[model samples]
Target chain A: MTTALLRIPAVRLATHLRRLGAAALVVASVLTAPDPARASREQTGDDDGCARDGADLPLAGAHFAPRRVEGGVAWDARFVVASDAASSFRGGALRFAAPLPAGEELVAAPGLGAIVEDGRIAGLCVGAGARSGRTVLASFFQPLSGDGASALGAPIAAGRAVQIVDTSVGDARLELVGAPLFEKHVGFVAPRAVSPGAREEARRLAGVREDVSASPIYLRGEDARGGLTVRVVDARARAETSAIAVGVAFAGVVGGLVLAARRLRRAASVERADALLASEIDAAAKEPAG
Target chain B: MTTFVTILDIACGRPIPAEDSGRARRLQLVVFALLASLAFAGAWGLAAGSQAAGLAIANLYKVPMVILLSCVFAAPAGLLAWRLSGAPVRGTDLALGFSGGVFGGTLVLAVLAPLVALYYQSSAWAGPLLGIGSAALALVVGTVMFVRGTIRRLPPGAPKLAALLPVVVTLGMQLLTLLQLAAIAAPIFPERTPFSGGIDHLAR
Candidate 1:
């Protein structure tokens, strides 16, 4: 009786464990779905999860110019705060992802924003709600020799990102008007070397963004870089030229041409020859009859 | 060589006696097929550049292959056109007509061989542009030849509309064959430029 009673309780405990395991699996999936960055649709300036609404305050444009410095590369970046939001942007600070390689010393120009350790820019005060358009946030030059190549990597590669925070909105981040990452072209250069994927993406985005026909521009090239190249072959194209083959094809053409010519000439010759034979036969028949 | 020249003249639509037409037609077909094959060889040689000799030798197989395919694709259409047009409908006649048109088209390319070589060596756009132009020209010439040649061969009492029927059927068949020829030879004469966007950087 005691053994039977214990077996019943043990079966109940096993059933409870199975139920618990299934419930935990469902909860885990719900929590860890996908990367938050890809799902962030905060472009509309909605107060989705903003502790403070920095939207509509000021739309800023960040422009970066890359230069070949004596020892390394130098960035001449300018941040233009919108003229309308003069007061709000006056005291706002700007930040940029450091493009310097590790262990390289950075020397900022005196008028440029104060350079804080680890690539942060400060001390840029926007004028009172008076002067509006472009206020230079920071301009700096850095020597990039020793570990420069590592930090610079490829000079022509994609550029470092720029981040902005408006002071009026309690230092809340402000979304810029253009893309966060600016592809830099140093001097007079061809159109930005867009990768194939980027080109397709741009075409697709343009289709959605603009009110034009949805025919995506298909570009062919040697590589993903948008250098253009053309393809010539098609279904109508043919190839069959070997010595023997050429000889055969040539013989066919030449022989046919020759035969056609001969036949044409012989056409008249044969008719004439037939007529003469007929006359001779007729004359012989008449003489015999006479 | 003189006879060959004369036959070319005939293919280009020189009038010949009806009695001699049969042999002339056969010869015309052979000449065009040969010329077309040679043009293909030139294209391969030009594209091959430094490897011209090897590519020329290797790609020789494409000549017969394209010809056979064109004939196979075009034969039935030729026969169909003859029947629909109420012509005498001899298999050989239709075959010869279709082949004649192809020869006529390829003749343009074969004649322009030296220019094609120079273009391939120096310019990217020239060769393909010429090739395309030659193809279009040949198609028109060939279609006309097939129609006219077929009409001449028809029985005395055939309907006028019968003339139109062969055009549609034969041109369609010939185009299909040409398309296949281009596709098969594509490996040898890969598309250097499908569309012209701008002057290539290298060209510039």
Candidate 2:
């Protein structure tokens, strides 16, 4: 009878459950199930904190190339998120010191979305299936206030935060690299075009690494608030030249005005004399057929 | 050097000497004044175009060429007006006065050149605006000087306005021509404006 009962499907399932107690079943199920959120954190080993491990693993790296636009300067920016086979970036945020100019949009690359709120870019996300190692995450153009060569030294500040899976890290400073070429009103040229001496001095002031031949200069530095800032030493020379030109121009204007005034005065005297002589001649001619 | 000084004196409204009153002497004075005008205009262009080396080189010729072309285009109209008006003023005398006006105008540009360059490097809006302002100021001053120089050469019996007929026609033609020329010579300023490209740019 027992054998016959065991042949029934429901009775067999009950017998199996009885053999493996409910407690044992629950424990096995819990141990076998996957926890994707925790697994991601464990694989990346970023459990401690994002900002604390910034030195060991930078959240992202940024590169900027400044070019002269119609009204101001446009900084062509590229961002590369830190990633490895076991872990990948999920999203990030960027806040500028000053609000971006009105009507300007932050254009992000495919597989990423940039959301601009007020002056900050928030809720930036990396799409699924993105490459893990040294992948370019996003790129956009940022407008700055300046014209011509003067735009070269304009101040720049941006706060970076990166998200890895469920763990979001704020205050993750980025490594900034300036492009090898700089834009002049005439066209694009290397920093050496500004004079070899100036280029050397600019590189020294910016503390660019000597080994990096591809990027000779890094215009950005960390500020008091932990945001990236731009430093341009070559702009000082430009300012000095501008001052001298203005001084010379002012003196020229003054001298020219004085000279013009003297000439006008002399001309007035000549005109008066000529008018007197002409009137006398006319009077003589009209006087009784003289 | 002496000839240059004499030309300068005449441009400043001094009476022409009897020996210098001949058509040949008047033509010489006009040529000298024109050369001087070019030099002054070139100086201003250097300062204004200092923003870029290529632009600086171009302006060296561009600024003076604008003045030269304006004069060239306007001279024939002035001569025609002189014949029609039946004025006692000689055409050569008119030419001399016009040349003097050109010199004066260019002198102003040269004087303001440094300031323009300084501003161009330092300020965004002010630089271009100052450039346009300086050019306009030079034009007004030149117009006044032209009228004064021409009137001084007129005979006592000649109607002043009638004698100035050629001057009026030349000035009008120059004004019209400069407007178009400014368009052709676009980018006198670092920033492009509606006026830079002239009527076509504005229409678009």
Candidate 3:
């Protein structure tokens, strides 16, 4: 930091700095504009002490942009559309217990080869757990509202196609919970109860408040740093397509320029020809006078 | 800064020293970060559920169409950036990097877009990916052009009318390309599009 101080300041340094700062702000907001739609509100947990507010966690922790979760941390989602019928599907689930960090899996299923409780979400660690990076990215719900075979709560095979069911942070993905998580389509109820119980047990073990809200419940607890839990609802900003459209337009311009240059060259050629002809005509007229 | 103070006086917006510095670096990083985010969305968003639909639309013809349409819109601003900036930047390198970034990014997105459509809520990735790819390409190219020293620095306020010339040229090119693609695609849509993954898909 001190190295920056050694340079003498320019007269326009302030102006440059201000402009740079403004430009940077615009860039940052535009970059992160796709923030999650989930409410990051520090709402109280239902005796389910999960962990810190999602805000405190580095974005790397969630493996999803804030805009992705701004939709109120989807407890789970079902596939609604399929981009390809020929794509493969695999079911995957991750189980979570209380006092756990978001995306942290307390238990693992066999698809990823039974990883122990390590808190890593998509290469990001939620807590200090040994060998947590081994945890595979798993989804717990059926492909929402779509027509494709469910992998059924299996390990996400990096390049292998799959779907996500859980959208919220600090929530465990239950392999035995959602329809996609179950083997042979064991119906939704059977697996959900099993997974919910496991999640509740983990919450109980953590000695935090229990979250029991309707079909889906969100657990609020003191941040790991013990900060107040302020319920923050996030709104995902819409990504504008016009900006991209601008690029397409730019390509056209490059072509147009070539054409215009050619046209200009042609006109210049004609103009030169006219000037030469006029000079010759003048010479011819002067000869007669002479 | 004088600019800051002046802007403050204008009451358009105001920022303190600390706020200014903090915001600057973050903003650039964030803007660049958008491509990454858009990439993720493209690879996995609505496509999580609709792979076939995505593949069905992935046609070579789409590239020309994109190039045509985006150039029409982006060329002008890109030219502005090239012509107006006081900072020294290479024009060719900027163009190569920008175009590379855009095309490479687009190609990557295109390769995976079909797969992404396999999951639910992933289809949203397509348009955004296309848009980002286009912008990323143009900006990268523009920046490269600026950096390569293709655009000479103007004397104090010398660009006057000349500064905008590049932009005008860019607009013309973009308009022509889009018009061309729309014309070409009009006759061979649905069939030209790969959303169906039928005989044409096998032809690819």
Candidate 4:
């Protein structure tokens, strides 16, 4: 009797549940992939977090690269270096070919722009890009160290920041610098909310709108290490030099596509339901309202 | 309320014309613009005499709801424009427009965000801009509608685009962002330097 009950038609929903369960697993893995490895760094007391003083030479194990960008600039050198805490700063390096003027340099980088007497780099300038024939960009996130974080303290699992120099023909626009451009620090990050579609799930997703403007903000030592992020600047694809007007117009196009998806999904569901109801109606009609 | 819901229902059923669709968006944009202009005037007012930041904050909070309502039209207008209007939407046009919109939107925010900070400090008599906000709001809405409207009426093959056009466009933006492609050119420029020291220690 127990085996017969298990084989009953009612158990068919079990197959669907299993399918859904597998889908959930796939989504979970995709969204929550392993976090980036935090290179361990020794943390000192409040004042002497890293270096006793500072050093200017390229770190022995530090990773650096030079690539050509789409803008007018000839080329750019990129760096991602890890260092010991001897210097208060984790590590430092900049593009010699294109540097910001001294005055602007102090004001440009949010946490790592100020120059020192010795010239050894302090404060990590997250992302760097050039405009007007000069590359200027920066993002300051936390360090892998225990006590030694970026300008912003402990990693803010999802924290993001951006710095940009707008040099459009008429006026300027904010460009994403060190911080991740689309995340919360910019006031319009997503993924703070992404749930499986509800039973009546609309096909399209919605996003909170935010202004992408750059302001020089004041951050303290306790603020960095925002979520480990990798901001990849790809020029090989020539994606950046793409026209500006095209980007703006696409926002409208994006909105339209979202609506279409919702309607199509809804229509498909409706059609299935309609077919089932029609078959039921034919039987009911034959029975004559009894 | 029922009437409003019905209006929303109609708006949802078919894509509204750009002129018609932007009605809500333009309202919100103008309100935001007006609020910005008001904040600007209020700052000038506070400096001169009246304290208007508090009132400004209160109004600022209301701005989102207005924006939410206005945003209802975004997807619809985009659909209708793509489906009904006969226009050519090249890859470049779509990209430039969205980027420009975001850029303009940011400036609009910067202009008004100051009022929020000010209102935190001042109590009553928050920023006042009965006249400026109204006018600014009108001008901004009108301008945005005009700009967006032109796009909707792209030369010809717009409406004929496969239903996939809109989805592809929308998904492309999010995908671009996820791939961290939005700021593709960020790695180079004015060049990068390793670090800058603290202000206090350096000055000393």
Which candidate wins on lDDT? 2
Q: How would you class the docking of model 4?
A: incorrect
TM-score of chain B of each: 0.67, 0.93, 0.32, 0.32
Q: Give the lowest summed-lDDT range of ten residues in model 4 chain B.
A: B188-197
Off by over 4 Å in 4: A1-290, B1-61, B90-99, B102-106, B112-127, B134-204
Where does model 2 exceed 4 Å of error? A1-290, B201-204
Residue-by-residue lDDT tens digits, candidate 4, B59-175: 332222222223332434544544554335543333323323322433344455455345534633343233224324533643353245335535555443443354344433332
Model 4 residue A51 CA deviation (Å) reads: 99
Q: What is the alpha-carbon interface RMSD for each candidate?
A: 10.3, 13.2, 20.7, 15.6
Q: Give the DockQ (C-alpha) for candidate 2.
A: 0.04
The Cα error of candidate 1 at residue A173, in Å, is 44
Task: Give stretches of model 3 more than 4 Å off.
Answer: A1-165, A168-290, B1-70, B78-204
lDDT per residue as tens, model 2, A28-80: 87788685322222111122222222222223434444544554334454444
The positional error of residue A155 in candidate 4, measured at the CA in angstroms, is 72
What TM-score would you give candidate 4 relative to the actual structure?
0.19
| lDDT of every model, 2 decimals | 0.43, 0.56, 0.32, 0.31
* TM-score per candidate: 0.38, 0.42, 0.22, 0.19
Superposed Cα deviation of residue A251, candidate 1 (Å): 16
How far in Å is the alpha carbon of A246 misplaced in model 1? 18
Residue A203 displacement (Å), model 2: 60
lDDT of 1 by residue, B1-204 (tens): 644564454455555444334543454445444445455445433433323655455445554445445555566776666676675545545555555555665555456555655665677777656645655665576677766655555557866465556556767765666554544354444344331111211122
**Each prediction's Cα RMSD?**
19.7, 20.2, 30.1, 31.4
Q: Interface RMSD value for candidate 1, one decimal?
A: 10.3
Model 2: pairs clashing at backbone N, Cα or C within 3 Å: none
